[model samples]
Target: MYAAVEETVQARLILSPHRSVRLRTVLSYLPEDPFAVSMAFPAEFSLDEAEDERSAEDIVWVFARQLLSSGLELPAGLGDVHVRPTVGRRTMVELRAPEGTALLRFDTTDLRRFLWRSRLLVPEGEEHLHLDADRALAQLLG
Candidate 1:
């Protein structure tokens, strides 16, 4: 059900060294927080589409790590901070930020909800999706 969605924005790929390496187009929406990331990768990475969804958990982890390593834009006040959900095992994500050389941590269930609400989960075999309204990515330019 978690299909990757694509759109264009001002996000510059920093970790990427080449111009032609665009396998995944990640979209992160954090208008209020400026740090929460809802990274969407190819459908092959989502366990939801697998016949044995539980077996595909490791693939999800690999994808998450690979995607995070590609580097997305981070706002100020997030020095040494990172937020990511761990594969199929995580119900909550670790929200970490640095303050005076020390890392502050908070476990939250919000990221999962954000990611779900950001994308529309169409049932399988649906060929057309008439999207008449905008999604979470609309907040990027606003």
Candidate 2:
């Protein structure tokens, strides 16, 4: 059995070329959800701005772990989220929704370090071994 892995990396909220805000972004992986990775940000950084009364909470975005891995070298993802390497050894993450979008920049080294740590627990090509097919099928049919 694999344990959960979590890391917090500093990110820049690119509001504009001339302005940006520093944010603490949390990256998490759980053995139960082997195929996916999650990024959690402050609730205010949500892609949907329509919610005017948000309590103190986190907005978590879950996506394929492969998406984030491939994105480090080339662009990945096509739907509500996108990740790609940027100049200066940084990575750009775009969160898109009908209401709004949030652009974030993260250090490539930080991301790589976190991925490496996660691989130590689950390893590459071993994620499938951690999945419970029966539980997933039951959840789908329930």
Which candidate leads the pack in lDDT?
Answer: 2
Q: Which residue ranges in model 1 land beyond 4 Å of their true spot?
A: 1-22, 47-142
TM-score, predicted candidate 1 vs. hidden true structure:
0.21
Taking all chains together, each candidate's TM-score versus the true structure is 0.21, 0.91
Backbone clash total for model 1 is 0
Clashes of 2: 0
**lDDT (Cα, 0-100) at 52 in candidate 1:** 66
Q: Which digits, one per residue and each the tens of the lDDT, describe model 2 over residues 26-98? A: 9998878888889998888765656563575788889888888999999999998899999999999998877
Model 1: per-residue Cα lDDT over 1-142, one tens digit each: 2344333222222222344122343445432222233443344433244346545322211123222322222222233434333333232122232212211111223333334433333322231342323553576556
- Candidate lDDT (C-alpha), each: 0.31, 0.88
